[model samples]
Target: MERNAPVSRFGTVEVEDLPDDLRERLAPVVERSGFTPNIFRALGRRPAELRAFLDYHDALMTSDEGLSRAERELVVVATSGANGCPYCVVAHGAILRLRTKEPHLADLVATNPHGCELEPRQRAIVDLALRLALHPAGFGEADLRAARDAGLTDDEIWDVGSITAFFAASNRLAHLFGLRPNDEFFTMGR
Candidate 1:
């Protein structure tokens, strides 16, 4: 019987290749997640930027903020979908499914907002995130008002915008580098 070769999704980066602080901080995440996310390895091509990126990412994603984990992942998936970033769409979509425990929500949010069985507030949040992703220049007070009307506090609105903006940057980075999603992402929590 022939043994199947393990597929490699991430490029190798030596510990010395990474900045000291980044390697330190990322070690646990890499170990716990069982794989360093492609973004981590890709960003390792530039260690300083990688460190800054991880810092900002944690601040937004892991903060005690107004957005729930599901809400933050929702913004990431919706915005990444609009940006057409398969890496983020797949990665964050998996997070959304896991956090919300709604296996099909990612596809619904990615393909069409109307298809998702979201509360009115969640719908407004996703709508605002998509607008910010696709037409950031046109985003204005009206958009903010809609989010506010959805019962999102001002800080929560800012969190939504911040998450949207971060993923926009991430989408471009992934596109520029042709980052690929890990295969595990596809079936995770589904």
Candidate 2:
């Protein structure tokens, strides 16, 4: 695996060395982001898994009916924080800021949603995401009831769980591989 840049724990396989399909897929991400996110490079070590993971991630993050883009990214940021994955926290926090157009919101949510000055609905949602991260097995019917009472639709509730679950896997992967957030992530949407 050849790394184009020194951004990942396991250096990203060089773009030229990637299989044709992988190269095609990665080109646009690099072009649009101006750099490859470390997750993309780290996961690229296993081309098949990278494709599968990206497909699922695109579906989960881009779905329009369930949660708004900002809401989805919030779930990721909050859960990533709970998991203590700074890479996800920083990267997703940048995305969350872009989506919400509020420069301070991501840092607020990532560090402490409960103490943050969020609307009731956002507070409920972030709280749920955090609990899901910290206590997946402890989720209960009351949790669902609370979210519903906070005005989240059934679809949105489902989205919250799905995003959190996906990032749980991603956060663990980053920790396992020692992936670091790209430097661009820190200043993005600032």
* TM-score of each candidate structure, all chains considered together: 0.89, 0.93
Clashing pairs in 1: none
Which candidate tops lDDT? Answer: 2
* CA lDDT of each prediction against the hidden true structure: 0.83, 0.87
Q: 2-103 in candidate 2: lDDT tens per residue?
A: 224346667677766778998898899889888878787788789999999989999999888878889899899889888888889999999898889999
**What is the model-wide C-alpha lDDT for candidate 1?**
0.83
**Clash counts for the predictions, in order:** 0, 2
Segments in model 1 whose C-alpha atoms lie over 4 Å from true places: 1-17
Worst 10 residues of 1 by lDDT: 1-10
